[model samples]
Target: MRRVLAALAAGAFLVTASACGSSGDSTGSDKASSSGGTTKVKVGVIPIVDVAPLYLGQEKGFFKKQGLELEVSLAQGGAAIVPAVASGQYQFGFSNSTSLMIAQSNNVPVKVVSNGIASTGVQGKDFGALTVKGDSSIKSADQVEGKKVAINTLKNINETAVRESVRKAGGDPDKVKFVELAFDQMPAALDSGQIDAAMVVEPALATVKSQGAREIASPLVDVAPDLTVAMYFTSTSYEQRNAAVVKRFQAAVAESLAYADAHPDEARQIVTTYTKIPAAVLAKVTLPAWPAEPDRASLDALQKLGQDDGLFKTAPDLDKLLP
Candidate 1:
């Protein structure tokens, strides 16, 4: 995971270094190719339950109705997608709010175009949680102190939320050893005792539970009620030059989110198209709130917690970043 971070950090540095050399042309006319009045655009996304709405949207003709055809490209995580979008490798991308904030703080020139996913705000029932082996002695977040707890990314949203959970549980978050492990690998790692605990979301969380893993804390919910965990974003360059396209995309995604939130069974069905999550496990997986719009108050709460955890070098400009 350290190697992945290092590679992504290098990619980000290259993106920052090349910002000044960009052509700054209108992407609507130059980048996005129109075929029979349909603008085809590529979107980088992580294949997770959080992104089910996008597939559902595509299937429901939400993007087609807007005259935009989406080409979904799967990536490992948001850390990789941010730079890819900033460099115009993709017209847009899905990412955790913290990662986008970090990129914006580092002058990566990204803009949030639409909300992605949010917590359910119910402890033990949210889409994401911090968990331990069912028979493990650790019963709460505080018990993770001096113990190895795995998070998908270091110094990102999950880490910040987990830290807050530990703090709220009356433990010193600094004392907990945080290891970087991908979400899919977490269940096996925890079962093998390779890690003391893991912070997981969606299908992975369901797999962990099937293994008799117990939820110790709902970290995302601990951050804030209905916390805006992730969002869809584009390069500021793309947004500025392709205003019409961006507007169309925003409307399409908003409809998609609303549709997914209302038709959860369809949302679950859509997950099979993009991810390998088992049918039984997928059925048990908790679906996150696909709010059509981001909750600003929730974002503010996340920003404060991120700042407290030193996740940002400079405070992200929410006014400029948000659509």
Candidate 2:
């Protein structure tokens, strides 16, 4: 999260955010395809480790093999990129399921083409966590009642999972106060007692633990096991127009996932190019479960949580969301 962007900031109860290298606005060429033959498209993403496979694909020439040229743009979170993709400036995008489903319920034109990340739910493999200071009194989820918790975004995946974990831990989630903060800022906030706990994702979470933070819970695993964290998506209209091109792109990313899984060190090294993380810190950062393909079931699990929170007025059009 230090180098990752929590790009978009939603308002009020549904508020959540992440980092951004720069905003992804409609100021670039959208040329969905080229008459010269290669499929050219802009891809929007958050700087989190979840989207490492896409970068791996780029580095390993997976996209090139598919006759595709991908332009990777970093945003704070899914909210910023949804408009970009909907407007055709971004042919593909990466975002959390809740954000995507909410967008679709509002009739956004995007459709998920692949599952991006999943929760490992273990000490090392876990990508996100509910962390508290080493000496903090909050030792269990039940203790989180009436406590202040920091999240990358207010109502997004992390917060939703944290609240669920709290309930599972025998605490009343409605009694907990959720505050929005960049993942990187969370450690300091926790240390300073500005927040009683933090729901954080890797590299940032890893950094905090290194500074002697203790895990109160692994929200991703405890509340939503193997829950779909984020995804690779594109405008629905783009897929309808260039189905073949979309398939090729998905294949390339799938290959990248394999590459990342097989060569983690090399893959983590490549992350440096996109994230501003220091070399030493990058080496120690916790990476998430980057899946080779999208998982519909896990996505639905996440969607259920979001829908229960009133994120969607209708069930997500799952059939249409699949790649």
Candidate 2 lDDT by residue in tens digits, 187-290: 78988889999987876777778778888788878645567778888877778888898899888988988888788787778777776677767877777777
- Candidate 1 C-alpha lDDT tens digits along 1-323: 33433545664434333432343442533277789999988787777799999999999999999999997776656776787777676798999999988887777788999999999999999999999999999999999999999987778899999999999999999999999777888999999999999999988999999999999999999999999999999988888889999999999999999999999999988988977788988889899999878999999999998898887879989998998
What Cα-based lDDT does every candidate model obtain?
0.87, 0.74
Relative to the true structure, candidate 1 reaches a TM of 0.91
The stretch of ten residues in a row with the least summed lDDT in candidate 1 is: 14-23
Alpha carbon lDDT at 219, candidate 1: 97
Whole-structure CA lDDT of model 2:
0.74
Q: Which candidate is the best by lDDT?
A: 1
RMSD in order of candidates: 5.1, 5.0
By TM-score, who's the top model here? Answer: 1
Q: What TM-score against the true fold does each predicted structure earn?
A: 0.91, 0.87
